[model samples]
Target: MDLLEDYRRATFFFESGDPLGAARLLEPIVEAEPHNTAVRLLLARAYFNSAQLNGAEAQLRVLVEHDPSDHYAHHVLGRTLERAGRFREALPHLRLASAMKTQTDYQEALRRVETWLGKNSAA
Candidate 1:
């Protein structure tokens, strides 16, 4: 199969919510496309869903380093930090996520982020 087909099939596994299957299929592709930011991000997210936070964090740290302005990466990292009760670390990412938010005007994600940050700071 063509590379696109392979990627599509792997994506199908990923979208089907089988993170391990997706990870298994995508790991090799990663070597061939080391600079594929999207792929890296997806793999990181799949790791996150699989409860492999360290693996997810590793991927995300690379992505974040590559593009410090990517709010989605920051958002995912923020959520993971919150889950771990690392609120201090979560604040910056959450703030970045808020700044990057532009869709769903009613969401007020920035406010939420700020609220969390404020709450943590207060404690």
Candidate 2:
């Protein structure tokens, strides 16, 4: 199968709530296609699910820089930033995520960002 197909399968596993399976499936593909944005982004999501926050953030940084208006990228990037204690950096991405869609997850993430921002501002 092609790398893109492999990546798509990995995403299917991830969406089905098997992130470890997705990560396991994506590990080799990432080595083979390091510059593949979709693979990198999917790998980042798997990493986040597996608690590999640093790895997730690294991949997302590349992804967001390559395409700034990738709302999902910014959403994941916001989650990664918040986990890293970079609350300020997470705010804009979270806000963008919220503005880009009306999903419950995005709204929840945005709410978390706002709470963090409030605390930060008060400090």
Candidate 3:
């Protein structure tokens, strides 16, 4: 299989909103090139977009471990956890991502998670 072609197709699938198809195309690429951060990131995003939170979390965890300085990975991991109702576990990751990057989206996610945690804890 042409990995590059597959990657491009996966990217197209993802951009076209067929994340499950993108993920299916990415899985083999990821296994063949485990060290390719870009492929893994795309795969994780596909999983996240497809509502496969567990897969997204797993991929994001590996990314964070591979490169702790990857703020995007941290942010996504936090989001996956938040979506899965693990706010407490997600907080640190969200905070770390926000601290690492000054993106508005990051801060917004952090705020959202914090608010969720607050409201839930008060219950």
Model 3, which residues run further than 4 Å from truth? none
State model 3's lDDT: 0.96
Give the poorly placed runs of model 1, Cα more than 4 Å off: 1-3, 103-123
N/CA/C clash count, model 1: 0
Q: Write the per-residue lDDT of candidate 1 for residues 1-123, one digit (tens) a residue.
A: 265666777788889988878776666777778789888887887788888888778888888899998988888887676666666776677777777775442134445655776876776
**Clashing residue pairs in candidate 1 (N, C-alpha, C atoms within 3 angstroms):** none
All models: lDDT? 0.75, 0.86, 0.96
Error of 2 at 62 (Å): 0.8
In model 3, residue pairs whose N, Cα or C atoms come closer than 3 Å (at least 3 residues apart or on different chains), thus clashing, are none
TM-score of each: 0.78, 0.77, 0.96
lDDT per residue as tens, model 2, 69-116: 889999999999888888888889988878987789888988887887
Ranking by TM-score: 3, 1, 2
Weakest 10 consecutive residues, lDDT, candidate 2? 114-123
